[model samples]
Target: MTVTPRTALTIAGSDSGGGAGVQADLRTFFANGVHGLVALTAVTVQNSLGVQGFSEIPVDVVTAQIKAVAEDMGVDAAKTGMLATAEIIQSVAKTLDEVHIGRTTDTPFVVDPVAASMTGHALLREEALEAIRTELFPRATLITPNLDEVRLLTGVSVTDAASQRTAAEALLEFGSQWVLVKGGHLCDTADCVDLLTDGSAIIELSGPRIDTENTHGGGDTMASAITSSLAKGADVPTAVAEAKRFIERCVMEAYPLGAGVGPVSPFWRLANPR
Candidate 1:
């Protein structure tokens, strides 16, 4: 007569402002009806204005945290964000293999490929970029990259539909099972169009672009929503579609917080009553 709640893990940094990173992921997980777990990679001193300073958790500590939660609680799905260095990324990939939580395994693992803060402060080191391509991407069930991250990862500037397709293909070459080239940063379009592909089947998630500067944590919210849906037994396409809808509503409900930029509110779920 006991029902077990679905669970998802976020192997990410901590946002002191509580609008992004594991904070946003946890909120998104809760909103999507899943238990959330975390393996914090770094701690950032940041606010609505921007990131000021940060500290990366030691690689061993990072891996150990992942191992502890994944082995004990059992992760149905997991996602990574703001991995600060090449050493950490490599160690994380190795630990993921040890824990059997990767694309090659049964569990879905999302790679957010976070390189910098939304305000353009670097969250990851320059050297870690290559490690993400060589190590983590290959282990990913899906890679969700904003237009800026797409350019940083693939050196392909995604401007329109054609470029989005190109960027997705480029990401696929790194061996991820699927790629989501997020077009939220593409201002030319009336609707914010995100291109999802697996080197063949292409699906476009298009929604009315909500005009708001308070889009902090937008990407993390979408990624965690996908992970949460995956934990609830949804397929990748279904999970992403549901996440797209979830995030669009979150953006629509976003409210101004600090002086600079506010966060996209996940509280929309409460008002909408699930």
Candidate 2:
């Protein structure tokens, strides 16, 4: 029998390398049994070596793409990545508000807060930081930030669990319903521990730290998995826990691509036949 899959939208840039950004998010949505939709914000000239150059889409065009999908197909959940500028961030925030598809609305909204490429090339402009914190954070249902992004957003360098909580609390002050402080960069630990909180209760989700350099798309994969779970009707905490499990497996199955880092493989699901 034919089935109608639940829909999730990604408002982000395109990764020409097929590793991260919209490419990774769409692949994740499909892997998790959700229909994927897009509102492309920018296009990057990148590879495993790094991001070389990029161009942002017009703000009006970005706004229109979001309106088109959210109006006609409907978005059960949505996420943002690599907005590229303060202009795009402000416009995307306004568009999300207009469509009623954010924290203030019933639909779940995820803010990945992408600031740089894995190879240390800046993806978000330096000036866009304030706009993202002030405009997008308040409207986010959940904000998933890697340790580096946490430091960039809140100026809190997370070296351990104590500091991780402090950073998550700081992000909560921005009005997001939940904050996930990803601890994959906490190199001191044997396990990759992510802290989830809503300003009161706290949950620690841990996974074995797979020893691999092919982790290029790891962040995008986890965030997209959460978006996919949210689209499939899971609650925030449940969605996040499920995403943690999904990403750990993807990381373990990661394979090398180019001379530099490679992407987390979602194709493992196909091989395992789950």
Candidate 3:
């Protein structure tokens, strides 16, 4: 007898460089033994150097794409990233609400707050942040935000562990059921620490720091990996743990492609299977 494969959906932007955005998400899902699906919100012109520009698809088209997937394939879990505009955010949120996706316990919604590229190029419209907070965040099963994004979203700076907790709490106030604070950008530490909290007990995930600038799609990969794990029946904590382990290996296996920053190896199993 054959078993059905789990399905994971990534509603995100497109990356011409193929290092980040929906491309990375799909790659991550597939690498984790998931059947990947996507609903594109925008198309980006970017590479290892930086993002040149991006153009958002119409709200109607984005909504239609999401509905097509939800009504047909019926995703086991979903991941959200790079919603470029207020209109797009609303469209994605409304579509998810209409389809009854990501609102239940079994099907998780993993959201990555992708506000900008690593080099400080803007990926999300400033106005879209408010839209996400009000409309999209409350429904998320988990929200993953790097330190920069956490500061931007909550206006809370991370000076230490307490400050990180404050920022995570502020995000929880925005209605995210759980918040994962990524500390890869914190240069003050010898090890990178990620904080996961659901307004209760906190789980601190730490890994030995790997010095590499090729972490272009690392955030997207983590969130997509969590979604894949959730679709495969892992709990939120287990899903996050699995994702963190995958990312550490990916960071270790990072390889440069161009003159600028490189991207993590989503398919680390191919090069270094464990």
Candidate 4:
């Protein structure tokens, strides 16, 4: 019998706490049955409580890491998270452009606009946000931005489903092929709703919100799940729906591990196999 190999890449930061960032992304990928690769943009000192310190890897180093993996092993789909600086974002954007222009234009690229951690720790600076919008958004196959990130990206305050639709439209204008505006921060209901828009149509995913403080890396895990599914040949709506369900399950099964906001268990699917 022959084995088929499916590879996915995560270009993100590392969290020492092991709950979010590259760690969470890799775990999600593994749980979804895909081989995971990483390109570390920064190293974060964080636990369930909060981030203490962070240092970004230099641009050249980041580029080299990306090139080393992409040129040899190859990637079916890729996701990005927590680009700490504008320079790093630009570097990644350039490398991705090279890949998209040269080889695979249909390769899925999921971009998680990680502006801040759940504990209110600043992940990306203000200038870096603009750089991401201008440089990387256009290249991404999908951009996942939470409510706060949507506000930061477009200066539009999202409060309800209507506002979320408005925000999604504005984000679509930013040049991404698809925009997933996560409404986990909305204060209206006990249900969490997220909007996925591809400039032409809108898809709403809603589920009962899990009441837990372990929401630290939910966005990263969700986006990674979608990317992994895409790598496995799922369509956009199917991928987003599966990813949303995966995240909700993770939140429900969240364990208290840190002093502050805990981390979602990306392996919840495997741990509680149906």
Backbone clash count for every predicted candidate, in the order shown: 0, 0, 1, 0
> Which residues of candidate 2, in runs, are more than 4 Å off?
none
Candidate 3 at residue 113, lDDT?
Answer: 83
Q: For candidate 2, what is the lDDT?
A: 0.93
**Candidates' C-alpha lDDT:** 0.93, 0.93, 0.88, 0.87
lDDT of 2 by residue, 134-154 (tens): 999999999999999999988
The lDDT of model 4 is 0.87
Worst 10 residues of 2 by lDDT: 265-274
TM-score of 2: 0.98
User: Per-residue lDDT of 17-36 in model 1, one digit per residue for the tens?
Assistant: 99999999999998877999
Q: Candidate 2 clash total? A: 0
Question: What TM-score would each prediction reach against the true structure?
Answer: 0.98, 0.98, 0.97, 0.96
Looking at candidate 3, what is the lDDT of residue 29?
86
> What does the lDDT read for residue 262 in candidate 2?
90
Writing each residue's lDDT as its tens digit, candidate 3 over 100-190 gives 7764545789889899999899999988889888887888999999999998989998877889888898999988788999988888899
